[model samples]
Target chain A: MAADNDTISGYTAAFEGFEASLNGGARSPLHARRREAIAHLQEHGLPTARFEAWRHTNPAPLANGCFPPVVTAGKLSAEAIQPFVVSGIDGPLLVFADGQFVPGLSRVGDLPDGVQVHSLSAADSETAAIITANLAALALGAEHGFAALNTAFVRDGAVVTIHAGCTMDVPVQILHVSTGQAGLTTPRTLVVAAAGSRASVVETFASTTAGAGVLTSSVAEIVVGAGAVVEHARIHLHGADSLHAGTMHVTEEQDARFTAHTFCLAGRILREDVHTVLRGEHIESTLNGLSLPLGDDHVDNYTTIEHVAPDCSSHELYKGVVGGRAHNVFRGKIHVHQAAQRTDAYQSNQNLLMSDDAEINSKPQLEIYADDVKCSHGSTTGQLDPDALFYLQARGVGLQQARGVLTRAFAGELVDRLQHEGLRTHVERLVSARLDAVLADQGGAR
Target chain B: MLKITNLHATVDGTEILKGINLEVAPGEIHAIMGPNGSGKSTLAQVLAGHDAFTVTEGSVRYENEDLLDMAPEDRARKGVFLAFQYPVEIPGVNSAYFLRTGLNEVRKARGEEEIDAYDFLALIREKMALVEMDESFLKRSVNEGFSGGEKKRHEVLQMAVLEPRLAILDETDSGLDIDALRVVAHGVNQLHTPQNSAIVVTHYQRLLEYIVPDFVHVLMDGRIVRSGGKELALQLEDKGYDWIREETAAAAAATQPAGA
Candidate 1:
C-alpha cells in the first residue's frame, strides 16, 4: 500500500511529459538537475509526519491524492489577482499565475541604475548561463523534498541582481497566485546583493477562492555579499484548504546584514524552513515571524542559524496566535561552530491559544561549540488570561470584543516590530482581517 | 438600593458565604468588616457576578430586579460595579482606550450614542483629577506595571467615570499608604451622592476614618454574626473580632434544638 501510495510516481510521470515538451538541450543543466530531483523523489517518496522535522505538519493529503499535482495551470482573469498586489511598492511588481509569469498583468516601473530585475524565464542566453551556474548552488540536496520538487518544476520566478555599491530606494514585490485548480504552483527565486549594496524584496502568495485546496512548493536562494544589506519579507495568505511549504537558504559574507520577516495567516497546512549561514566576522542576521491560524489549520515554522565565523550575532523571534482548533508549531535552532568564538545568538518564541481545543508547541534549541559564545533560547505557550478578560468584561465591554482586544494585543507585538512603515501597515491590516475571519468562524460554530 | 436574602456562596465546592443577609439603601455607605478568611472579598466578588463563586442558595435584588441572574457585563451595564482587590494588568491595551470602551459600551446599552475621541479626552482628563492620577497614566497599558497605589486609584477613577449605583469596594485600602488612602477616599467621597449607594469591605479601621459607613457588619466563619450602626466599627477596632465570635457561638449553642 505504501509503495502504491507513493505520490512521487505521479510527479515522475508528469516530469516525463514535461521533459518531452521542452526543447532538447535548450534547458541544459537546469533540465539535468530537474531529472535528478524527480529521480530522487521516485526512489524516496514525499516526506511523512514520521520525519523528526516534519513532526507537526502532515503532507499526507497530497500523497494520498486528496490534492493531486497540477501539470497545467488554470487560466485566470486579471480580476482574480487584483487583490493580492502589494500597493506600496512602485518600482517593480512581478506577477505569476501557477508558476508562470504573466507579463500583461504585471507592472514594472523605472528601476535604479545597475539593478537587474526580471522573471527567470525571460533570462537571455548569457543571463541564463549565469543563472544555471548559480542554480541549485544554495539548495543542493534532495533531502528537502519540497524544495527539490520546486526546483524540478520551477517555471518562472523573480530573479534580481544588484551591482556593487548600488542601493534601491523602492522595494521589488513578487506576487504568486494559485487560482484554485487543485494543482501545484512552484516558483523559485534567486537574489544576489552585490558587495556594499542595499536592497529589499517582498514575496506574497495567495489563492483566488476562499476554501479551494491547492499545493504550493516554493524555494528562494539569496546571497548577501560583503558589507551588503538585504531585507526580505514573505507573506503567505493561501486559502484555508491549501498546502504551502517553502524553504529559504541565505548565506552572508563578512560584515553583511540580512533580515527576514515571515507572515503566515492562511492555509490548512503551512510549513517554512529558513536557514542562514554567518560565514564571516561582523555578520548579523535577524529572523522574525508572525503566524495566526484558524479552525483546524496548522502552521509550522522552523529556523536554523549557523555561525561559522567569530564576532557574528543573530536574533530570532516567532510569535503565534492559534484560534479555534488550530495548531501552531515553532522550532528555532542556533548553532555556533568551534572556531566561531564571540558569537551572540538569542531566540524567543511566544504563543497564545485562543480556544480550549487550540494547541501550540514551541521548541528553542542552542548548540554551541565555542567556549566564548553567548546563546540563549526560550519558549512560552499559554492561553489568554481569564483575569484580564474579566477585567475588560466588568467594565461593560462585551465578551466578544474583550476577546478581540486581547487577541489584537497579542498580534500587535509582532506588527509593531516591523521597521518598515508600509510593510507594518500592510501586515497590520492582514492581522485585523485574519482576526475578523477567525471571529466569524467561531461565531458560526458557536 | 441593593438587597441580599439568605445568601450562600462557595468557591471550588467550599462554602464561603453561609446564609448571610444584608441591605443598602440609597445614600448609604455600608461597611463589611472581617478578619482574614472571613469571605469579605468573596461577597464582593459574588455581588459583581464573578463566575468562580457559585451561589448555592441566595437571591440578590437591585432596583427591584434579580441581580444574581445577570452576567458580569450585564450587571455592569445595570450600574453595578466592584473595585477589585488586585486590579488585573492587561498589557498592550491603552488605559484611555479601555476606559473609553467601557464608558461607550455602557452608554450604548442605555441607548445613548458613543462618545467621540475629543469628548472622551476631555471627560477622562476631568476624571483623572478625582483619583489624583497623572495624565500620563491614561496613555500607558491598563494597570500594566502600575504601582499598588496607582492600581487602586485607577479603580476609583473607573468608579467615578462609570458612576455605578451600587459600588462594592473590596480591600481597596489593604496595601495603600496614608496619603494614597486619603486620595482614594477623597475620590470616593467626591463621587458619592444620595442617588447611589456603596458597600465598603475592609480589614482595618483606618479606611473607615475617611469614607465613613452608615452601618457596620461583622462577618465570621462565612456568616454575619452582628450588625450595628457606625459605632460598631470603632468598637471592633478596639476590641477585635474575638468578642463577636464568642457571643455568636454562645447564642448558637444556647439556641441549639433539643438533640439527644
Candidate 2:
C-alpha cells in the first residue's frame, strides 16, 4: 500500500511540474482536462490486481515504475524511421519521436480535397479547435486508469480529419518511434471522419532498440460520422524491456463502417483496449488482431462493442502465438442495449502455445438486452496438432520445418485479412521472420 | 526390397499384430486381404513408422537397413510412403504450398536441387491431371472440407508427386465412390513402376480387380493363414472369410496333441 501511494504521489508531483511547463497554454481547456485527469489519479490511485479488469494482467511494473515523463524530444533521422513506414501509400506520413512530431522525418504529399492532417502539438488554430472539442471526450468517460494516465501526461500526437464526401485513396501512416530511453511518453491521436467520408489510417508504435526499458501510454479517439468508412491498423513493435498501455476509443454514427486491426509483436508488458460504440442503426464494426509474444513478454487485449442502436453488426477475431514462457490475455465483450434489436455480433479467439510454459487466457462476454439478436463467441487454445505434424513429417518434411510451416499458417490467417497489399506483405514478412527466430530458439520443434 | 520376420506389435498394451510375417520383392504388388481387426492397417502403420504402435518383436529389413530404427521422416526420405486410411485436414495450409514443401524436403534429403515454383507448378498440373483434380484445389486448404473421395484422391495424388520406392495403401478404397475408387486405383497403377513396390491392404476383392496384384495373402488372427496367386483373392471373394476362419480352426485343432 505504501509503495502504491508513493507511485501515485510521484505522478502527482510530476503533473504539477508538467502543468507549470505548459507556459502560456496552462489555462487552456486541454490543460484543464489534463489537470482533471491527474486529480482523478490522485483520488483513485493506480489500478492493481484488486481491480477485476486487472486481475489477469498485473500493473505493478507499469504503475510503480520510475518512468518520469520525457523532458525533451529525441533526435532522429529520416533513415531511422524509413524502415518502419508503410510504403506504397502516397498519403501523408507523420513521424513522432518521444511523443513529439519530427517534421524533417515526415512527408505530407498533396492532400485530397477536404482531408487535413496536422500535428496536435503544432496544430493551427482551426485544427486546434477540432482537437479541443474531441480530444479526451471518448476516452476519459470509460473510467480506465491508463486512459486517464495518458490524458494526464498527453502532449503531441496526430490529428486527422476527412470532411464530408471526401475519399482518401491511400492510407495515412502515423509512425511513433521510441528511442528506448528511460522515461515515459504519452501519444494521443484524434481522427474525425465526417459524414460520407472514406479513409484509412495506419498507426505504428515501435522502438529503435530491441530491449530498452521505456514506458509508453497512448490514447487514440476516432469519431466516425454517419455513412463514413474508416479503417484503422495499430501495430506495436516495442522493445523487449518496454511497457506499453494503449487505448483506442471509437464512436460510429448511423450507417458507418469501421474496421480496426491490431498487431502486437513485442514488449515486456503490453495492454491494449479498444472500445467502440454504435450510436445509430445499420452500423458495421470489425476488429481483427494478432499477437506474437516471445520470451517472457506479457500481452493483454480488451475490446468492447456496444450496440446502442438497432440493426448494428460487429465481428471480432483475435489470435495469439505464444512462445517461450510468454503469457497472453484476451477479453472481448459485446453489449446490445434494449433498443438495439436485431443486433448481430460474432467473436472468436484462437491461441497457439509453442512452449509448455506458455499460457493464454481468453474470455468472451456477450450481454444482450434485446431478444432478437444473434451473438456467438468461441475460443480455442492448443499446441500444434500431433496428427497434422505427423502428416507433414510423413511427407518428408523435417520436424522443425513442419512446425515452422504450421505455425506460420496459423499466424498468417490474420495477416491475409489485410486488404492493403504492401502492408500485408510487410506484416507477413515480419511475422514470418519472428516465428523463424522463435522456432529456432525452441531448438526445432522440441 | 522388404522383409518382416515374426512381427508383433501392440497398441495400449494390447497386442494387435501377432507374429505376422510378410515379404515384398521389387516390382511386385502384394495385396493383403482380411476381416476387420485383422492387423492389416496395423502393419501398414508400423511400416510407415507411426508412433502409436509399439513394435514388440520384429525385424523389418527395408533395402538391407533396419526399418524400425528410423523415424517416420527418415523412412519417407528413404522412399517409403503410406496412403493414410484417414487423411488429416490441415486448415490454412494451401495444398499447392504443402505439396511443394513436401517435394522440396524429399529432394533436399536426397541431395537433389530443389525445384523452383514454376517447375513445381508444371509438375503439379501434370499430377493433378492423374487424379482428375481441378486446379482450384491448389488454392484451397489441404484436405479441409474435402469430400471423402477427394481426400482419398488427394492421397493418391501425393503418392504420384512423391513417387516413393515403397507405397503402402491403407484402405485407400474405403469411403470412395466407385468412380472415385477407379480413378484413385488408376492413378496408383500409373505411378507404379518396375523399380518400386506397393503393399495394398484391402478387405474386398473389388479393388484387386482394378490393380491386379501378383500375390494375395489372407490375414486372420494377426497371422497369414493362406497365401496364393491373384486367384486366391477370387476364391475369398466367392467363399468369403468364413471358410478361411473354419479352415484355420480345423488346422489349429489338428496341430493339438491327441488326447492331451
TM-score against native, each model? 0.90, 0.97
The numbered model that scores best in DockQ is 2
In model 1, which regions exceed 4 Å deviation? A1-9, A24-45, A63-73, A88-91, A112-116, A123-135, A163-171, A195-197, A210-213, A226-229, A254-257, A355-357, A439-446, B253-260
B1-260 per-residue lDDT for model 1 (tens digits): 78899999999999999998998899999999999999999999998888899999989999999999988898898898899999999888889988999999889888899999999889888899878899999889999999999999999999988888888999999899999999999988998999889999999988999999999999888888899988999999999989998898899898988793
Write the residue-wise lDDT of candidate 2 on B1-260 in tens digits. Answer: 99999999999999999998889999999999999999999999999888899999979999999999998889998899999999899999999999988888889888999999999989999999999999899999999999999999999999999999999999999887799989999999998899899999999999998999999999987889999999999999899999999989999999999998
In angstroms, give how far residue A327 of model 1 lies from its true place: 3.2
Docking class of 2: medium
Q: What DockQ was computed for model 1?
A: 0.64
Residue B147 in candidate 1 has what lDDT?
Answer: 95
Interface Cα RMSD per model, in Å? 0.7, 0.8
lDDT of 1 at B118: 96
